[model samples]
Target: MKPPDGPDFSARWAALRNIPPFLRMVWQASPALTLAMIALRLARAMVPVAMLWLAKLIIDEVVVLSQSGGPATLAGWWDSGLADTLLVLVALELALAVAQDLLGRAVSYTDALLQEKLVIDISIRLMDHAAGLDLASFEDASFQDRLDRARRQTMGRIPLLGQVMQQMQDVLTVASFAVGLILYNPWLVALLALALIPSLMGEMHFNARTYALNHARAADRRERDYLRMIAATAETAKEVKIFGLSPWLRDRYLTLARRFYEENRAIQRRQLTVMAALTALGTLAYYAAFLWIIARTLTGTLTIGDLTFLSGSFLRLRGLMEGLLSGFSRMAGEAMYLDDLFDFFTARPRIASPERPLPVPQPIRQGFRFEGVGFRYPGREAWAIRGMDLELGAGETVALVGENGAGKTTIVKLLARLYDPDEGRITLDGRDLRDYDLDQLRATVGVIFQDFVRYAVTAAENIAIGRIEERDDRPRIVTAAERALADQVIAKLPQGYDQMVGKRFARGLDLSGGEWQKLAIARAYMRDAQLLVLDEPTAALDARAEYEIFQRFRDLTQGRTALLISHRFSSVRMADRIIVLENGRVQDQGSHAELLSRPGRYRELFELQAQGYR
Candidate 1:
């Protein structure tokens, strides 16, 4: 069935229907706090009715005392004993006032705690879900839009949870007032309800329009966020300053923000006009009711206390009804926004493991074989790799040499199963790659891309991230660092392995590009996987350092399979065999001497680089 195209009342109602699940999530965050908040709200809800009634009693007592010739002076009034009833009523009011204040404080405190807990819970869930999605999903612009919206809702709509509780308390308070009015005259209840509907409808309509506008502008909002970050962040500061882009970026932000402001301003103006008209109608109704009550009081049918109580009740009822209706509309809008969060949560990962996954082969004896394999990234026309045929034997080292954009990294990704081939198949030990468990397959191959993350954490923690379970294993960390030739570099720091590595944090000591590469290479060593793919691991290292690292690489990877991608023919020649790639196809494959003996692309490219040095 086709989904609905635009915002509708039904979708808004459905958003309201998500309240139970949201509450359930809040409850799951902290049942004790949730219960405390509810209890406090309930207790606070009745205080208004009690306080109003007590005021009526005190007023009636004052009227009686005055008619019976009360004392003139303050001291006389205190001693006359005619004021005793009033004093007792005043005492009860003071006590109720204190209790109400305390309950309100308690309710707010509980909500604040619940809000933090809910934010943390929702944030964790978002991270976990994003981690499970396929690489393609992250690359798609539409999927990014959905993710951005959901992320904003996670932090932005936290107030919705507390608003729901407030609304509930308001409902109970309104009910108490409604019952009092109904006792005096049932028609008064109907009059108040009639007055509220028009404004309520207006609020609900504007809310839907607001959500629709925000929904359509999600991508623009993302762009605004990106531009803001780029204009002000440490990572982009150098480039932004060099290019003198501050004014341009600022203007761009203003343009987008102004468009949003204009659209929102239009809605707000319409909403205000409708609200004013409806509020005027409501005022007329209230005055008409007020005049009717006055006539009854003048006719000797109702006492002064009754007059005060009914008037107060009617006024309170009007405000409470207005709040309840408008709160409901605002909440519907909030819940509609929650559709983004729920929609993201509901999205199932296409790359999830099968229910009954085949076990990963032990030792991977036959190695990996790709036959007629092809894959194109999402939303791209050309294939990244096509009609590919390759084989990596167990314990053999292979080098993939190619110019930029020749599908070098794409092959590594395919081999690591970051993406499944769109055409043909990849098999490990004669079993299709998808047949094995997803996690196990990833665990079996360790890949370090050219652009690796430089984490702003302790040196030990940085390496530990490669195999997080071994974070506490100091010996394993040391061994991996030693293998990556990072131990001596780390030893030079004041805190050694405990030293923070990135410049982003306080007291952090930044490393040179070569040092950071060495640290990243340590992560692969930490993985200790059977199949290792290194994409230009020595790009930042000096020539001597590069040759030394490759020497260590050959020595360290004696019994394991490895694939090295580089433009440097010096490193490529060290491989047991070389495969030259061009335009997503393997143009040639052989040892360095055999390729050099032939008049082919590999020989021409090799000589081109060699001549540059002379």
Candidate 2:
């Protein structure tokens, strides 16, 4: 199906009115700075009004001086006073210009302070929520997109709010100009306001399109950005060079960036042309009024000074109106992006703490049972796993063997409670797994997948990441590394456990494939959990290393229930029980001796692998 059209601008504007008691919150947070900012803005505005009035006086007085017939004329009487008035006006203008500059500095510093506070507040709040979300939700793309955007862009809202503060000064400046022009023609003020209507409309139209573009391209933009990172980042550089794929990847990156730039620039060009045409029309009308006032003064319908004031104030009045109109639209557009950020900030987690959670009842002693379990992903035609039945007794190490698409990972995912079963009950001991606190349940299980991460940090940090809270426990970290046979790696390093493990940063060393697998095993061993899963965990290890590691793995999982997957039949032969699966259904399950003797699918698959190894 086609995706929905992009953002709704009208909806976002309404959100500002709903900003949770706006001024009160801002006032309570920084009242003194807020008031000081307003006062400076008001004082800056007065300088322009006083300048226009002085211009009108000088124009009329100079014209009269030019027309003087007698030696004692109005100009002669006021010659010395004119110099004083001009000096005072010049001084006022300079002082106001200086004050505005000071205010510009103050606003920048104030914005910096506000932005820092916002980032801190939001990061803290989001991190707190992140710890509460289910590990399964992290896999959901929609959830990830929200979390990513909020974390990256939410801090920009503060500067937008500061822009709104500046707009307040612009609005007041416009009002003062209108009041000063009243003596010439009251209707001229109304005309000036009317002329701004087209420009305001044009601005709103452009903002709508811009916001819509942002909303629509968020996913693609994220992809392009991530690809650029992969292309340029130090960690990916070695693999890219060794594989001789840098040229191909660079071309692909340029393709995506060009697409984004071309589309946005097209829209910008169209919008800019429309706004420019409207601005030219407004300029024409403003000058037409200036000429009309001059003609009226020439015909003796108005005083010369009145005409001068009317013309000077008219030009300032037009600028002030345009600034006000554009400022409002700018503020609204900025707020919409903030709303996108806010949406992520306030998202409802797929799994959250119960209103009144019962403490975790003891560790599983009986076993886990899946009765008529089923699950289908969003926008899928069929269930990934459906109506499956399985039982794993406590302390039993079972090996699940299957072909490529046989749903082995799906079952393991369910066992981890990353996604709830659609049509089944999953119970631990005798109670449902969902009834226990999510954190408690997850804390009891540990997993190492074929695609484990290689953290570009210290050797100790890489291992201790399995239990982040226990990272500072040096004894525990060392023990876990020793169990995974990674102590030899530490011994080879210049600084042992303190040595950096990846070359992304300074003073770091890269690892071989087999070595990285050992590090992953060390990470898994650090979890100290009852249920452990190793999915093709030794796929990268050499034959001898793989075999020896299995011997050590037996020691690491001595007291825990474990699940191991391997294409190598040697590992499967050692499991207490073997479950052969074919296309999402269990074909047979029994001890190695029993399954080998039975001449079933397990025996056939075992012989095929055994033939290859020979």
Candidate 3:
């Protein structure tokens, strides 16, 4: 599956303006709630502006009262009627202040709730799409980067959108002040508009550069994070010390961090230089206005009270300029980041599962056949398995033996339908494999690969994951554990079947490598499939454990077609038929006694392993 090539950010940003579905969702989910929240925020903001204006009114009223014609005493200023006006303003101010606090908490809580909902929605959708994609798509580095960016941004998108509301309210405050200025002098209103330019440009330039660093260093960041985990994680600590790999992984992490720091330093330098220019522009305008305002008062055209009001309003206007400038740039950058998230959210898998899937009949009568099959890995020149002709009949036990890097696993993957064969076909009961439902085909084949997943879950849950839709039968889970000879391992644990099998969690018990391998085997046994494939499934088991597993393997595979791959001849010898694979083709195949009689690749491997036992 091909990933989207080279994101056109400009095109994507333009597309964000057409926020039909996303905005519609917010509206539909809680239109009244959203509007109520916005109204509360706007009401909260007006309180601050009113408080600032009321301050001036109080000062002006005091001046007028001081100049009144009637004979006045100190007692008059403290009179009940005069005190009541002051008290009402103070009371209103306190009420508005509490309203501000309440609104802050409410909006923060609502934003968090919405942001979580959005992340879950995006994560689930991405997981669904990721599931639909063929395994080959994960090979693309660009695809992984897209996934990472989408996930991170989705977590924070709503908070950023909420802040955009903050910027709008601030802008409205600036407009209200400017409209007041318009009554006094239209020239002051125009100057207020002109003041926002320098800061906006500076802010936009800095944020874009910061995001560029984040984009360029995505892989290195993840590597550094993994290195940290390995250094700190409990299970890895012992191995890390034994291998003397801590210093190496730490050095690798430091290298990535140093590179990130250098990029960050460069960005800081650029930001500081831009900010200096912006600061100089604001200083020039502010000083020139200060001198002009002083001259107006000295020449008797402007009263001290008028200057006081203008000065206070201009101070508010200046804060608004800074707020709007920074806020708008932040919003634009966040919107661009959101575009990346939205792009990924909307990424349809390159492979669309057919809406009407063809049926794969159960009981798998004759078994699967690989006919003239061939496969080459992605971005590779040579074939991993070329023209591989293989077959397995129902109720047959077939063993595949091969040297390292031989095509045995590749053939297994093809049979599992993890990858589509480049040429020719695999058939089930003489019907083309593609004609069968993908899920149904997988459900019919139970596979345990060489590198099986050691899920960090409870022992019961781990075994039950082999066939998750089976309702996690504890009795069946216990039976599978006994058949794989994992009973002793589970019994020693603190919580038995309920015990978590990874050191990542608190109170979780760790397992030996052999123990994990047995658990993996038991997990595979939970699947009631027509075919069972085990690839190097007991590499961690001791000689005795290996012998016992093969003794039980016959019982586990009774009446089912089974395929196994193993290096140990003690286990391989039990197979009814053995097939040895070389570089990309079959070298020799027969019963163990017959293959031993032939003195071929299989015989040489058997002797080599038997020598190791000595």
Q: Using lDDT, give the best candidate's number.
A: 1
lDDT of 1 by residue, 1-614 (tens): 11113367777777888788889989988899899899899999999998998998988888888898867887998987778889999999999999998998888889899999999999998999999888888888999999999999889999998889999999999999888888889898899889889888878888888888889888999999999999998778989999999999999999998888888788878778888998887788888889888999999998788899889989888888888998999999999988899999987767756788898777879888989999899889999889999889888889999999889999988887778899999998888888889999999998888898999999998888889898999999999999999998899989999999888989789898899998888998999989988899789987678878877887899889988888888776888989999998899999999999989999999899889878
lDDT of 2 by residue, 1-614 (tens): 12223346566467566344434444555666657666766766666777677666766666665575434656665664544554565566567677768767776676566546555656676688776676656776777777766666546555665666667777777778888776557878877888888998777767766766766667776777788888878768778888987787788888878877777787778778999999987898798788789889899997777877787788878887888788777767766666666676566556544666555545668777888887776556677767778887888788888787677787777777777788888888877777767778777878888889989999999999999999999999999989989888788889989999887778889888888888898887899888888888788887678778776776668767888777676677678887777766778988889988987888888899878877
Which candidate, 1 or 3, would have the higher lDDT against the true structure? 1
Q: Name every residue pair that clashes in candidate 1.
A: none
Clash tally for model 3:
0
State the weakest 10-residue window (summed lDDT) of model 2.
Answer: 1-10
Model 2 quality (TM-score): 0.83
Q: Write the candidate numbers in order of decreasing TM-score.
A: 1, 3, 2
Residue-pair clash count for candidate 1? 0
Quantify how close model 2 is to the true structure by its C-alpha RMSD in Å: 4.7
Summarize candidate 3's per-residue lDDT along 66-178 as a digit string, tens digits: 66653366576566366556557667777767877887888777666655655566567667767777667677777777777777765656666576667767877887777
Quick one: best TM-score, which candidate? 1
Mark the regions of model 2 whose C-alpha exceeds 4 Å error after superposition. 1-95, 119-152, 155-159, 226-262, 292-312, 345-347
Hey, what RMSD does candidate 1 come out at? 2.9
State how far residue 215 of model 3 sits from its true place (Å).
1.0
Looking at model 3, residue 443 earns an lDDT score of: 84
